[model samples]
Every structure is written in structure tokens, then in C-alpha cells.
Target: MHAALTFLLLFLMAGTIVPVNRHFRQTPGGIPVFVVSNGVHTDVVVPLREPQTGTDWLEQLQQPQLTARFGSYGYVGFGWGSEQFYLASYGGNFPKPGTVLRALLPGPTLMHVDFYQQAPRPGKRVVALQISRAQYQQLTQLIRASFRPDSTGATVLRNAAGYTPEDFFFRGRGRYHALRTCNDWTNATLRKAGLRAALKAPLAGSVLHQVRRSRFHAAAQ
Candidate 1:
């Protein structure tokens, strides 16, 4: 009985201690960005181009090899997660319990990039926010830093097959575990961009909760 009570308390604490909305100042001349989700996972989507290509940080994705595959998309979505779990779950094979355990423990990770011709339609699983150019640049840096670059200063592509033609996996930095999950990475990226986010979001719900709260606040203002 004591152990059961302790577990219940811990679970409650875990669910609530991470602030779903933290106050942050948006950039004075911010641009629109989107946070998208698919029930279980979340992604950060940024514009694929700008008026001036010279300063477009996402131009790397337009390289011949990638462009030939992803074609022309006005936005790109980025996600990072456990390699085995991601591949298994996305490749039409549900991840085994053992695979999930491995990811929740400690293991390698991957970065998944998906292209979209238009911003995802707003829904319960999607939200958009406005941020300054400086904030956007900071977010881009956070994403680039997450990639494991090869000797040629390019993100190292994973040899494994992707689940879709519009998306591909690349080697990622750091390890994934129950405490530091893909949602945590997304939350951290939002914080780095000076936006409201869960302080330590380990689940997709927590991240999305904060995003929705931010949107509500923006609308109220």
C-alpha cells in the first residue's frame, strides 16, 4: 500500500511540476512558426524559404540529393527520437515492447525531417506561433546542433530506409531515455527560441499543452 501511494504521488508530480506555460517575451518582429503533432509525436515546422535566399538557413535541405527526393516544399518539419523505435513504428512495424524499453533506457537517436508544401491545417494536434527573426535563427541553430555532422560539415545520413519518400532520417547527437525524450528536445527548442514551453516535457501531451496555452494567451491579447 505504501509503495502504491508513493508511485501515485510521483506520477502526479511528474505530470504537473513541468510548467505547461512559462512566460516569455516574443521577438519584436517575429515570424510565424508551427508546432505540429500526430497524437504520439511532435515536430517543429519552419518556413522553407524567405524573400532572400542568401540568409535562408534551411537551404541545406535544398541540395540536389535532398531536393530530388523531397521536391519543393514550403515548410519542413523536424523531429528527433530513438532510432530503433522510430524506424520500427514508422516503417509499418509496430515497435515491440523490448524496443520501447530500450528507448526509455538509453540508446542512439535519429533526426527525422519531413517536408510539407503547405502549413499543416490547424487542429487539436497543431498550433502556430509568431517569433522574431533572431528567435528563428536561434531555433535553427538548436536544430543544426542536434545533427551529427560528418567530416564534410554535413548531417550524416542514416543508411536505414525511411518510411516515406518525403522524409528521411539522419544520425543525431545525444542519447534518448525516459527522462530525456523527443518531446524534451522539442520543448527545449521552444525555450531556446524564447517561447513559452513546458519546463521539462517528456511527453507529447505536455508539449502540446504548453503550445495550446501559448496560442490562447496570444489570442486573448
Candidate 2:
């Protein structure tokens, strides 16, 4: 089963006063950019301020992994805090008419996956995750789908109506088109489908999990 990893907005403004550098990374294009890390070096470049750039990036993930990760679909989003990310896992079987798809993310860390029968529009499926195999699959698919034949070539998948680089990755800092920010896509989509907030408020004490604890702790001192 291949799963597509997606995210939902927990914070209306991503309320982190942290330095922009801490949240952003440099791209091969020599551009300083914000990104959504998949717990791997490969990141989804987010053009929070640039529509042309953002759209180009979003289009790239549409081809393969975005559709193949997990089983049929998966999603990624913030967990209980800013430090925790999540994903949901599932198989690739479309249900009978009106039979909505459902999946779960493992662990008791206040995280889970919610499957939407129609997303971005009716008859479309969208997966939202806070922590689970879906995140893993989404990240893996992003990595797998990366690598254009050349710099001029588009990222493997960039034309699917459902794949929005800005939304799939991280929301940009400003509004673009109808989306006030990439986060809006997440919030609107999940909220439209009536999803409860998947993330608790950002932890004041810096909630770092094992993989990030050492690095996060080191920076605190």
C-alpha cells in the first residue's frame, strides 16, 4: 500500500518567535528558504514568499513518491509541539461509494492520522498526520521523488491537481493567490473536512524528541 503524506495547520501563524534561520535552509539555487524537514537531509523547498518558486516546487512532488509512499496515501503535520512531526499509514484499496478511507499512526504520543474521502475538492483523498508511518512514507516519497534529470527539469511530479509544493511542504511567510500562506491550505482543507486541531499549542519548554533532543538541548545552552 502506498500512502501520500500531507499536513494540517495547527498554528494560525505558526507562532514561533524563533529566528528565521533556525526554521529555514539554503537551497542548491543559492536561495535562503524555509523548508519542512522530513527527518532527513532532503527537504521540500518552500517558497513562502515567492509564488513562481513555490509553485514550481509544489509541482515537483506530484509525479511519484507523493502517490506511492506507504500504500495509497499518507500525510505529515505537527504533533503535540513545534518539535514533533507526524504521519499516517494505510493500504491502497479504494473503498465502495460513500465508504470513506481511514488509517492510523502508531504510538500513544497524542498523534494520529485522519483520512478524508474528498480533499482539495470532492472525490479526492487527503491524509493528515501528526506522527506515524505516514510521515515516514511521505518523507521517503519526497526523497525518492526528488532529483530532476537536470536543474531545468521539473521535480518528478509537479502537475497533479492535489500536489501543492507550498502546502505539501511548509507554508510560506506571506499570502499568495487565494492562500494567505501555505499553512492556509492545511488549515482550510482539514478544517473544511472538520478535523480537530492535531497539534497542541507549541510547548514553551522546547519539546524535543530523541532524534532532535541532543541538537535542541545543545543549542539551548
Candidate 3:
């Protein structure tokens, strides 16, 4: 009982301190991008096609298999997490204690991609960010690099039955653990894109809070 209580205290403390520090900066010549959350998970959304660059990269990469899946609006969202944990949790089967424990250790990760027919709306759970075109390109590269591509340079797809048809999972680059979690991936990607984020956000709440703070600060300026 004492050990269980100690662990509970540690978990609570982790939420408060894992992120450690927060910072915000405005990227010059930035374009509009989005940070979206679904209470527990967060995703970064970017354009699927850029008229200025004449690049239909998503269409080119996905080709015949997934090209038809996306709609005219042209946007996609990317997220990363423990494969088992994400599949089980999102499929409505909450992870068992053993599953959670396994995920807390190093484990395989998956990258989730969702196609949106239109730009996602900003609400309580979503915030728009303006970052330079170069930053957006950097963010895209970060996401693409997270996937473990196959011999043909295509991302390996996994079967995630209950998730939306428009979304797919790809084998990811690193292991997922308590310290390097899904939200941490999001925070790291934002930082790679030259955006402001918490130093290390293990929880979606910490990431969303930092994004919201930056959005609010930008608005005030």
C-alpha cells in the first residue's frame, strides 16, 4: 500500500514538473498552421498541397493507394505514440495495467496520419500558429523522418481497425516510453519547426497549455 501511494504521488508530481520550462517565440514570414487536441491527444496539422510551391507532395507520396482517400480541402494531421497503447486506447479498449507498464518502458512507436477535407476548425481544443514557410517545411520533414519507410520508401502501415478510415498508422522511428511519449513527439516537432514549446512535455495537457500560451501571447502582440 505504501509503495502504491508513493507511485501515485510520483505520477502526480510528474505532471507538474516533467515539462520544466516553457518559452514562446514568433517566427517571421510564418504561414498558418494548427495545433489540435482531443482532450488527451494532440496533433499538428499542415497543408497537403501548397500552390506557391506547386507541390502535391502528399498525393505524390501516397499515390494511388491513399490519394483517393483525401478530399479537396488538402490538409493532414500527424501524431505519434506507442503502437499498442494507441491502438488499444483509440479502439476503445483501455490498456490493462500490464499494457500500460509495457508502454512505460521502451516500446515500438507508430505515426498516425489523418486526412482532413478542410482545415480543422479552431476551438477550445485547437490553436492556429503562424510559422515561416521554412518552418513549415521543417515540421513536414520532422514528421516524414519519424516514419520508418520500407524498401520502396513507403511507410509501413499497420492494421488499426477502430480508427477512422481516413487515418493510417505507420511504423515509427523511436521507442516510446514514459519520458519520450506521444506529446513529447509533438513538442519536439514544434521545437524543430522553430516554434515555442515546453522543454519536455510528456502529457498532452502540458503541450496544449504551452501552445495556447504562445497563441495568446501572439494575439496580445
| lDDT scores in order | 0.76, 0.25, 0.75
TM-score each candidate. 0.84, 0.19, 0.82
Best by lDDT: 1
By lDDT, the candidates rank as 1, 3, 2
What ranges in model 2 sit over 4 Å off? Answer: 1-145, 150-152, 156-158, 163-214, 217-219
The C-alpha RMSD in Å for every predicted model, in order, reads: 3.3, 17.8, 3.8
Give the higher-TM-score candidate: 2 or 3. Answer: 3
| Tens digits of per-residue lDDT for model 1, 71-168 | 56678889999988987886577899988888888889999888788888878888888676777778888888898888888777785357777777
Which prediction has more favorable lDDT, 2 or 3? 3
Q: Which pairs clash (backbone N, Cα, C closer than 3 Å) in model 3?
A: 30-131, 30-132, 31-131
Give the Å shift of residue 165 in candidate 3: 1.8
Candidate 3 per-residue C-alpha lDDT over 1-221 given as tens digits, one digit per residue, 9 for 90 to 100: 99988986577446534443245455544566788888777899888886644546565456456765564657888899998888777655678988889999999988888888888888888888776667677877888899888889877777543377778787888999877888889988987776777666777777777676663345545
Candidate 3 ranges beyond 4 A from true positions: 1-29, 53-57, 160-162, 215-221
- Rank order by TM-score, top first? 1, 3, 2
How far off is residue 221 in model 1, in Å?
4.0
